[model samples]
Target: MCGIGGIISFTTDLGERHRTADEFAAALHDRGPESGGRWLGRHALLVFTRLAVIDPVGGGQPMVGRSGAAGGGRPEPAVLAYTGEIFNFTDLRDELTRRGHRFDTASDTEVVLRAYEEWGPACAERLRGMFAFAVWDAAAEQLHLIRDRFGIYPLHYTLTDEGFAFASEPKALFRAGQAQPVVDRDGLRELLGYTPTPGRTVFRDVREVIPGEIVTFGRNGLVRRRYWDLPAREHTDGLSETIATVREIVQDSVRRQVVSDVPLGVMLSGGLDSGIVSALADREVGAAAGGDRLRTFSMEYVYNLANFRSDEMHASPDSPHVATMVEHLGADHSELLVTTDDLMDPAEQLAVVDGMDRPIVGLETHVAFRRLASRMQPTATVALCGDGADELFGGYIWFQDPWYVQAATFPWIGPFHGMEMHSGLVDRQLYQELDVPGYIDQRYQEALAETPLTGEETAEDRRMREITYLNLTRYLRTVLDRRDRMGQAGPLEGRVPFVDHVLVEYVYNVPWAMKNLDGREKGLLRAAMGDLLPDSIVRRGKSPFPTAQDPAYRQSLRSRLQTISEDKSSGVAELLDVKRVEAVLSAPSQGLGAGVNRLSIEAALQLHYWTTECGVEFKL
Candidate 1:
């Protein structure tokens, strides 16, 4: 919903960087173009750019407030700059007010600031929402960075020679001009290896604030304390009770999230995840607002339907199902049809990397949608989707496949190993030094250890839980990041009720048997919302976001790669074997395979563009 960045230290350069923080905040214009501001402290500086989704008139950034418990002589330690939506701000506000807290504005930002003053870092435990915020504690001379339990919001920070710098997006840190977008050997490995090593990022010095953590940077150095984590416990609820609880929590999350001062809508797909969100949103919005039609949007490739074939990931084109739901719900729907040229556009592809500030493993669709959303629904600021449902409810094909689930390492890597060569063309010694295999295994073990697999457990249950945790922490992290970058680039705020901490925690503890009941992926969810949606939608199988299947798209990529290959002084040429690159390009591609060749070409092209355009330096 907003962008927040700041620098803290005894660095004298604050004079220039404070003003540069303006550009740092300005770089996120797509994320929040409505308004912006900067606040400078003797030893700290903060910046905020806002979308103004709530109490637009009253809420603005780099806000300063006194702690509720501060004594008359004590210094007011807390100054807050935040980005996110606190769905339960109203409830928290009332409780704080009852306890003698006064408010000057009718906005959630004030409620959060007051809550922090009243509770300190402990405030995160009492709040329920997706948020990333910074609180400068002047009394302690400490800077605090906090992220949501599941990390739905993005926060990255790192210590510098002068002090610490933090930002909602990595590019903001770059714009601040303290840290370079230079990834070293290890950063390169994580970038290409397809592993989500918590805290590690593509930039050598910049790191993500791990989910559920409140990290404090001060004179004593950095300390991290986790505020919440998934608790493993025995399932006591019967099938009926579990389903009822799922329905209740999920409905409530959607109910709270749909509240917005700006235009709000749902990102609809034929899949069960988005369908259920659409259905619940429709009912909730209708009942609350005199039966207005729900607004929904879906994207499709220009000739995808004509070229579509049944694959492991998709059973049918989304057109028919989308149509069925549009008519069934009587919703206001818009379909954006994009050509292969649109998907392959170098500028659009470049925007994807620019938006992410890394060579991320996401589809080109994310980039296209960032532009499409603005054109289709310029007024729509908030949109909800079912992002984490697959990881939570076992909707992916591998979740149901015995062979894939039983593998030792992360389930996705083996099948997609070839794609892991994001920097395959890099000098061989550099690639060898990356130790992609070793890095992936190390990260996998770290994640597995954090998963509390207590009590007696069957091999099946334990393995499934590990797999689920991997998807939740790693796969889902990438998914959420991609969604944020894309949606924010559209200047639209994307929310996911399926990622509600309570819902994720509850469904996580449920036995796999219930989640995949009757041998179907997401079976419990289907049964819970069966009567609410048409059988056609509830029965629709999982389909990954659609991609352009046209050969022309592949040709466009191939041609560009060929052109770059011939350039003797190409920035990417030193790392690549031109003959080998030419061979791969000449090899057959149906333009539809989701395998090594497709991904390698995509990654290589992306890396080239990013390195050349962004002028990324390899400090290796």
Candidate 2:
């Protein structure tokens, strides 16, 4: 629930670096409207913009504490600039207090500092939550950058000739002048392809801190090490026991994340994932709040019901199911219905593109996130929802497709993504130069190699491991990054219980057979929460966040694409095949979610504006 940025460089004057840190923090002020601060030293500077989700009146950063070079004994200066919530901070604080650590603030920031003081980098292993933090260990004269196990929080850094700079968003790093936003070949592939390569962003020199990693830098140079990862093991629990354990772990994560100093609610999608979380939250939080009920929210397009139809991707619109859940739970509910006009507003769509810091296409659930966050910010500071569930529980329909499951490349890359659908629109030579398929193959191989493996496993089990790994590492990051941007853009915090590392580790090793016990996608999760939810929700097939289905939206997009094509000065002009574009404009609208031409138009326009806004220069 905050923005963190800093630069650790030996080349710049201390005052100069301090100034840069100020600018870096200023760039992300929207993320932390509550308060902001900066910490400076001879060779290190950390800046923080905080939106208080816990201990609202206290726990400001860059918070400083005392520690030893070896993490014990004589105290010396240790500065911390941290973002994201640590759900286990209360317990850790108690344990640290027992060990004689004194506290002046009732904040998780202090616990994190104390944890590092007591256990050094090993503290990351004992912590459970979403966090991206940078600590200046004055004793060791080294800086440490750490991200959570699932990469729920984003942290990007670029190493420079003098040192390195890190930030909550890549745009902050660009503002700090640590790196420029230039599109290299790989970056182009990443922008055009479904998922970017892990650790690779649209900016050439910029690198995202890989999830579960702790990167440290000192006189010895940079050293990156994994603090956590999926642990492979055999499943031994019976089906009933496994389901029971899943229910327990998931509820624990939800209850733990429900902690907040401000008002909170749930993003009720009406599907099983959000439904399960909202039900548990209502039960637990309702009891704690003296019978007060939980608040829930959902979104829809103005003419969605009229235009929406059952399709391969969406069985039905979310409105009806959402209504069922809201009535069933008897929770306070608000449904925001948006029009195509609201979605196509140039300023708003451009802002979404800039917030993402890449050439992302379409405005499906993403627009809902931003619009809902804006509306909810006044009432709720934290909103919990169901993400990471599908990836973990095999919920995506494509997961059930044997063709995708058996494919040599990542299952979600080609067909599921429509990766090659826009190739014809790209300047043929430029498209050939991007080598999209080659890039996918390489990154897919890299992901496969990184998947944790048990000593021995069945062919099906092994294939499942690869597919799950693809979802966890590649697909999931894209989803998480997008949500974080929009949620924080509203200056609101979004939490996902489904992403808790403990639950993820346990469910990961469960056999695919048990995962689909009812011969349905995400059957295990459905089984676990069945008793708490209505049969309508429990039996409902998986649905993605709703996409605008109105024909007017398609007309608006085509008009914009035509306008962009007419202006040869547009950034995407180099990528377009003029004839192909004409065909796209002339092609019949595919109504709602089914058309490739419609999507291509949307993608082309978004990419053009994103490139222009980010000041990107293509290497090719």
Candidate 3:
């Protein structure tokens, strides 16, 4: 795992290339603190900071490699600035060796370089891991940017005066003066809309390399080609066969991902998804004698156990379920407790926003994960998470709710409509100008148009498929982005085995009935891995990542909002409706569980901090 950034200018000379690369590297220091390197060419400059996961000494970047076909009339060598692990590197390496490719290091980076040399951009199709990488093809004078199938690792790029620049995070581009931190009307709409627009970011002119895409920038400007996508296919396998295949693919993904040179562990959430991963990982690691016991980690609130409240989102505290799993697995486990004070700390809140590179409404979740990553960093350099399972297997409540499944908008947005009153607090005229509703409708239609279909499924099947696609392609991106930004900020590499494209592809075609076989969310997943987990965990309902339920947390938010409302010169003051803000601040405390109060307060506070701290220039 590492941080990669670079500039590619084909028409103009970059005199300050070294300085720009240095700034980019420095901005990404936390992501890769072990080592750093740069490769400069006439038209391209690549810089990378290393986390030293595999073959620490030898696996360095920007790694340069000569194309296997580099002779006669071929292009020059390709230089790769890459991040994320390639679970199938050893297998790909063996194939490459058989095809006469020589190896110099036991690193996936080299395998990726050689694979690109052999297969060109099509090599992205063969890779089966979470990654976002850049390959400056010296021969063709074209720069190729590729992200994994699920966008597990982030890569953002923007068109520059000279040519273009790309980085692991948008901050690097801003820090390098490649892109400005400006949010226009559309950007603000995106910020508040909660509907993800692929290839677009909250910063204008800055675009993300869409997941499962290869974007090439060269003499002709730029071209984007989808190297992989969820295919619409008919399922012919029986129930038992489907279950067996899922088990096999998931286990293989876990087995492959455990190939880490540094200390590794699982982010055991005591849910079906993470429990399955933890169990499978334990088996894989324990297979080798003298192998270190699998380490597990979970998060809890300081007073959650004593004052826990069941709401629509969470059924019970994770500690009890966590304890059950820990004892059942008999693995090394650690629980990190987060307090309302921690969630309300100005510095911690700002850090969460900074890590996300945007204003985050889920401040508690991000803060907890950020701290959890910090705690895990001391014992693990890499941790496997169960992120994509929900999207792939119909695990969220909206997936099972008919209201959401049949809704015209994104499924998750329906329930949140009543809960998300922050929009009402925005300046009325400014909110009208933003047209967040129209923007969301437009984005929803666009996503629906892109939904792949077989043209043979029943009406119900088609709707389910569309819902699944929206979850995977749109909603899941937010989840993965949070994991990547927070985990990498801790300098910990987070892997999601459930996101393996092979697994996602196969499970995506399964009918909705089978997916919700027992009329429960994630029923298919439960059937496949239930035996590995304690029966209680297997029977537990879907509980989203826990939030601070303490009433003090609500008081803290109200206090902060009051402070912001009184500060005349506050950056976000002009954007908010003061009367509305005061009303929210003065309203009786509803505790933090009410999505409306919590999310509204969080949005206002985050917007204030983001605008003030990040020096954001709003062009509305």
Which one is best on TM-score? 3
Off by over 4 Å in 3: 67-75, 287-290, 421-424, 589-596
Q: Ten residues in a row with the worst lDDT in model 1?
A: 589-598
Question: CA lDDT of 584 in candidate 3?
Answer: 68
State model 1's lDDT: 0.80
- Superposed on all Cα atoms, model 1 deviates from the true structure by an RMSD in Å of 2.3
Q: Which runs of model 1 end up more than 4 angstroms from their true locations? A: 11-17, 67-74, 287-289, 415-429, 588-596
Q: What is each predicted model's overall lDDT from 0 to 1?
A: 0.80, 0.83, 0.86
Candidate number with the higher lDDT (2 or 3):
3
- RMSD (Å) per prediction: 2.3, 2.3, 2.0
Better of 1 and 2 by lDDT: 2
TM-score of 2: 0.96
Off by over 4 Å in 2: 16-18, 67-71, 287-289, 414-424, 588-596
Give the per-residue lDDT of model 3 (tens digit) for 488-582: 65679988999888898899899989999888898888988898889999999989899888878888888898898888888898888666666
The count of backbone overlaps in candidate 2 is: 0
TM-score of 1: 0.95
